[model samples]
Target: MLETLELLKISTREQDRVEREFNMGGAQSADKGHGYHVLRVQENSPAHLAGIEPFFDYIVGINGIPLDTPESRVLQDQLLANMDKEVVLAIYSTKEQELREVPMIPNRSWTSNPGDGLIGLSIRFCTYEATNEHVWHILNVAPESPAELAGLIPYTDYIIGTPHVTLHSENDFYEFIEAYTGHPLRLYVYNSDFDACREVVITPNHAWGGEGALGCGVGYGYLHRIPKTNKYHNSQLTYQGDLKQQPQQFNDQSLPVEKSHPSMTNTDVVTVIPTTITTAPLIIETPAEPPETNRPQQSQQYPNYHQTIHFNNDKVPLDP
Candidate 1:
């Protein structure tokens, strides 16, 4: 217990040196420099399920003491070098505020706070593209998705739609991803060949975790697919004189040169379509009053800070 207290005292001093008040981002500073802070506590992360997020402004000291910063990197470094392997965090647990010392034993993956009652949400490594074909084979929007919720559907390739969806580039597919963050969109899709078409709205929800957070859809890689579309031909070709260009034929039928891409995707996506809530939904472009700019801070002193220490914990002193 004495040794643990000493470590805590040292860690607290380090945290104090780094954590500065008045940051631009939301809360999550306590376990700042320690390795534990990397495992974010978003409602979805394992840490969050373990009842982490217990307090805010984890700034225990300044330059080897407690404090936050005014949006600068120097101060950030000062706060991070003080952590090691014993800080614990979560939403709720036996110990309320302050971290409960945890040994730096690898694979100590046990949390008292049950866990995120498993679900079937599929996760994958992927990216999305924008193509006319993607928009051409149109259909209705998927309800409860970002697209549909945005009040737009993959209908008649609206080269122009509200919410101002734009093509970021012919190469970077994640271009429109920014459009989905904090905003939802509804989509309508279709495929002439399959004689299948439907509306399914999709939204991109991402969060970063482990001490500090990044965004949703963890364990993925650099996604780079162009967001493109294909030309929507109303009528299929009858006896074609030049359809030979399409070297590939299905069921002995000449096919069109397949040269179109798709849009916003949920990769390796494992999902269970929810029951279509009241068919008619509302889409607010600019509500009379926009939603709160930032979420509410749970704690008092210097709240509104979210976790973010993108380094491996090694700065703290070794116990003798």
Candidate 2:
């Protein structure tokens, strides 16, 4: 078994080529370098049964062997040769930021499709970056849409990830939103204008009379990365401090006003204050209230329309 697996090993030159092609920054430790990113894991398959999660997991090694090869055929060949035999896969979780070993026996009977691999997983060779730099840039959010209602700001906000799941690919965010359709999915969003991270809850639904579930256009890749400037860094800290103090100030003001009005019962006064304060941030940050004369003419053209917008040769459907 050991000799058969040795065939999967590539030359040192080939390994270097792999690193260069994927921009993995040369040789890295066994646990933190290049690996095959799991894009999809078929249900009831060996990979899924072994707790391999799609989009957030990477297959780094097979049978204690690090898969540093450029081509995915190396990993496929190893699995095919080790069929029916218990093989240990070195799995890396992007969410947990850890490496673990999962044992599974590959077989063709897992799925009805004849073309399905023994492991039943779709993966692509890529470099793994242990950073929260990746983000989905919000482009246009439809008026009265779920995204707008949830406080997502177009061209200003970026969806980083959720509390539990760390988004690895562009499709990860879309898939997550679909999974939580009709249910609230809390996301950690960063604003370019504020340079701050905050939690936003969005309930995605198809009944919102929009083309997409969230009614928002999100762009990924290098162009959408967060700006690396300290221009707003100092202000972000000051803004966060102000946010904490605002609630206390509102509470103090509301209590005295409630005492002044004895006719307006305690329950009515208490409910009004909480609702007003909770939505205060959204009201203040809303971009719709700006005068059209002050804004650009092109932005006003698609005020209530949803259409495709091309960006760098890629077609992105944007809602306004």
lDDT of 2 by residue, 54-171 (tens): 4445676675466665433445556667888877676664433445556677887776765445775655456566432356688888898999999999988876555334444434
Q: Which candidate is the best by TM-score?
A: 2
Q: In model 1, where is the ten-residue run with the lowest total lDDT?
A: 120-129
The root-mean-square deviation over C-alpha atoms between each candidate and the true structure, in angstroms, is 27.4, 21.5
Provide the lDDT at 26 for model 1.
28
lDDT of each: 0.22, 0.49
- Give the Å shift of residue 300 in candidate 2: 14
lDDT of 1 by residue, 1-320 (tens): 01122222334443333223111122431222211111112233222332222111121222222122222232123213323222221111101122221111111233222221111011111111111112221234444533334443342322111112322322211333332344444322333333222333344444322211112111111121112122211111111111111111112111111111111111111111111111211111111222333323332111111111111111111111
- Against the true structure, whose lDDT is highest? 2
Assess the local accuracy of residue 158 in candidate 1 as a C-alpha lDDT between 0 and 100: 26
Candidate 2 regions off by >4 Å? 1-32, 136-143, 146-320
